[model samples]
Target chain A: MSGGKPLSRFHQPIEVPGRRLLHHIHLNFVKKKVVGGGGRSMNQEIPLIPFIDFLLCIVLFLLASFSASGELPIDKNVKLPNAMNAIEMMEAPIVAVTATQILVDGIPAGSTRAIIDSNTKQKIEELSEILKNKRELWKQLKPNEPFPGNVILQVDRKVPALVVKSVFQTAAFAGYPAVSFMVGRLAKE
Target chain B: MAGIDTGGGHGGKRSSNHEIPLIPFIDFLLCLVMFLLVTAVWSHMARIEADAKVPGPPREDEQDKIEPEKELHVHAKERKFQLVWKEGSTVVEESEVERVSVNVGDDVTFPELAKKIGKQWTDHGSHRAAADKKFDRAILHTDNNTEFGVVIAVLDAVYTPQREFLVGNKTEEVPAFHVTFAAK
Candidate 1:
């Protein structure tokens, strides 16, 4: 001990090879003892049980919400129409028609303004081409099952029906007969 | 008891007093939370499924020749919807359907239009309204300049009115009519 204070076991005094050394011992084996006002143990135990429980619950909920199809990519520009009687969303190649452009499978296919302005009863050339390619890819992936011809239309609520009609016709021309219009789900009364 | 030893008071300290490795557990949970938050789909997405008819050569056989079992055509315009019932090929003038057009004015929005359309279905369109109600299938033909919102609003209105029907063995509440979407 130095000046009535215990030294840590590691800081032992050195001695000659032939000489023996004597060290002071204290009842308190620890390096230091805190003289806290409260009669409490030296160790501070963090309240971790509640925190762990919360994290586990969060993990469980997120796992439950996770779906096999993964997350559906939503375009911020498209304000989807709300529907009360809509069914659960199906898996299909999404054809999103935004304010300015039309996208097939997240890739820009054509200009929305041009399609609306033309007002032609014909299928959209660009959209149809991309959809056809998607169809071919689908056919290759699932050779055994007949192609469902399912396609999802994610169109802005304000988009005129003319553009939607053109997209519909284009999807049909590209062998997509089953069209699913994606919409926000409204709570039932 | 089966956990990491914190090395507390090591003089004759027993391993049985070890505590759970909460720090490491917390780290693992944090990683999982981040992964799930990134991957989770928060919004509920719903689908309105319909068949898009492709223009093809007129059927040589009976599919086209035969009178459509139920011919209910809806002409969707910019501000009005003309709900028509057809017999054979002619658009019915007024034997069964009382009103054809439900117009949306400056004050009347699509929601109000939906309510009006739903009123029509619940009042006269469904077989529940009348035992001899004409159509069970309706065709929606949307025109240019009409907003897609209006089209979906009309669909929601049609789908709103439901009746419990015996299907196979179970009786379930289903939409009054099956709607097919078409563009003209």
Candidate 2:
């Protein structure tokens, strides 16, 4: 108790060492509080649930909202026709008919007039040959299954009905009975 | 607490609560968002089924069964439509002709023709006419000079009549007929 006596005016000279010792004790208490209790109790980990939520949102958007139809190349030359009531086109062989030329999946088969003139009676010869070749290739891949005779016909909005009808006939003659006209959605009237 | 504790027990000690390195993680998230946004396709392409009217040899029994078949011919002229009703391979007189011109707000308007035809079909109690009925199939005849958009508009009008039913909060469209195309 005498060693622990309070410092007074008379003890001021001896109190310098005591003050330094007291400073160390305060720092130790602070260090313990910082490292042991309140600081550790305050968890610093980034809340993983929000990051997980963001990841799940992105995954759901990618999986659920993605279009079922794969990308179909749009020809710059052919302005696709518009329709009020239309459904999404399925993936199939494409027959693109512009004003001047006809393309089978981006490859020029023949001139529009040539195909029409070659078979004035309905069956377009060149297009039918191209489609027939395609059908054969498809059949080779799936020998056990029947060929799904479907074609995606993309025609320019300015093209005449005659050319479109001829293409339709050619598709039918080529063993592809179903022709789906690829069209853009018409704006609301 | 006083004299001896300072030099005996305390020295330079470092803290252990190091901050998490988050810059790379944030960068990863930003890149992923950009990649998904850039590759996303928003617009949808649609299809309208087109079938060729192939002329084939008619069987004797098939001809006998179809001798009484009725047909409706829709001739799409410039700015007008001529509706001709056919009965059993015979073209009848008294055809109903209607005109479809561009409205004030639209570039091409042909739904009026569809509305008129729908009215006629409904008046005749043939709105739900079967596929075997002549009204169920419409032959759309158009010229080469006519715009394909106009033809499609007319086709839309014929195939999908404006009559709709409300199901819950959504309105449902009632489709009418299958259309065949003829070029002049």
Candidate 3:
């Protein structure tokens, strides 16, 4: 006991500022200290809360955006005709031709087939004139821009191909060049 | 010297480290959310809808009001082409013809049939004149089993440039020959 140094330095009690009181408690309770004579600090651990919050925000944003855009309702029973180059419908007029009816923007327009016989040539001419007038009116509505005007032809699988072609020709004659045939994507095999 | 030791000890013992500010990251994520929402809405706004139905002719009693020249019935059977004048219920003409080998069981080839009809129109103009002035329409009756492709082929043939005279003798060239699908 006589050879040992005085206990004053080893048992010294240090005073810290009041604002650092909680910090001191956390340091004592949470961090492990090395007890070797040579005392040095080690690198502290990084917090994970902010990183987690960031990822959550990203996920939530994606979910919110996807939910807002509604999917186009296509009839599963009808199989649409395929083409090598089919463009997506963007700002195009929708013309739905079901097995029993023809609808333009959900409104019933006319019968699927309109033919001109020698006797009804006058009627056919009248219809053609009306279509031409409508095309002119559309052009007037959106002047100075290349008519992004398109026709969406939704035909049933059972409808005759001739009927479909006739409709296509009629629309083409009416001055709409871009036509899109809508079809459902088949289930993966 | 005593104060210095105490200060060093406290500084070394501090557990909570300096952290990167998260406000910037939150702002970035919010911007991304807005961008995605705007894009989704734009796609929805760009969509369009259309319908595809073929029309058929009216019935006999219903046909009384319609002009006779407006209806022409074309009966396509195994190997015969029968042209019926609708208003008079009179068989204007019948022509026996060789059937195309193409899967045209009851479906007539429009091109071949149209050519034959064109020849008949020229040859029997007198008979057609005597039948009805409104004999402008041709009602095509096909078998249920006939392929739509064959019918289209027939229509293409009938409405071909060469067969345009079937519709009218007008100086202006008409691109389509008038014919309607007759209900069975």
Tell me the TM-score of each prediction against the true structure. 0.68, 0.68, 0.35
DockQ-superior candidate, 1 or 2: 1
CA shift of B46, model 3, Å: 14
Q: Write the per-residue lDDT of candidate 3 for residues A1-189, one digit (tens) a residue.
A: 233335465664644323332233345434334322234555554555666576677757676657443655444433443221122465444555555455555655555444311212112233234446666878898787766446666655466544454555555556554555664322111
Better of 2 and 3 by TM-score: 2
lDDT per residue (tens digit) for residues A72-135 in model 1: 8778889888877888887789999997999876799999988767767667788988999888
**iRMSD per prediction, in order:** 2.9, 4.7, 10.1
Docking class of 1: acceptable
Task: In candidate 2, list every pair of residues with a backbone clash.
Answer: none
Expressed as tens digits, the lDDT of each residue in B23-115 for candidate 2 is 566566667666766666676788876555555456666644444444467887765677766665677533454675554233355677867
The superposed Cα distance between candidate 2 and the true structure at residue A5, in angstroms, equals 23
* Model 1 lDDT per residue over B94-161, tens place: 22222234333311124544555556565445365333333366788776777788777767766766
Please tell me which predicted candidate would have the highest lDDT against the true structure. 1
| DockQ, all models | 0.47, 0.32, 0.07
Off by over 4 Å in 2: A1-46, A64-70, A113-123, A143-146, A187-189, B1-30, B55-68, B91-94, B103-107, B123-135, B162-174
Count of clashes in candidate 3: 25
Residue ranges of candidate 3 with Cα displaced over 4 Å: A1-78, A81-90, A112-137, A146-149, A184-189, B1-184
Q: Indicate the residue-level lDDT of A7 in model 1.
A: 53
What global local distance difference test value does model 3 have? Answer: 0.47
Error of 2 at A56 (Å): 1.7
Model 2 chain A worst lDDT run, 10 consecutive residues: A15-24
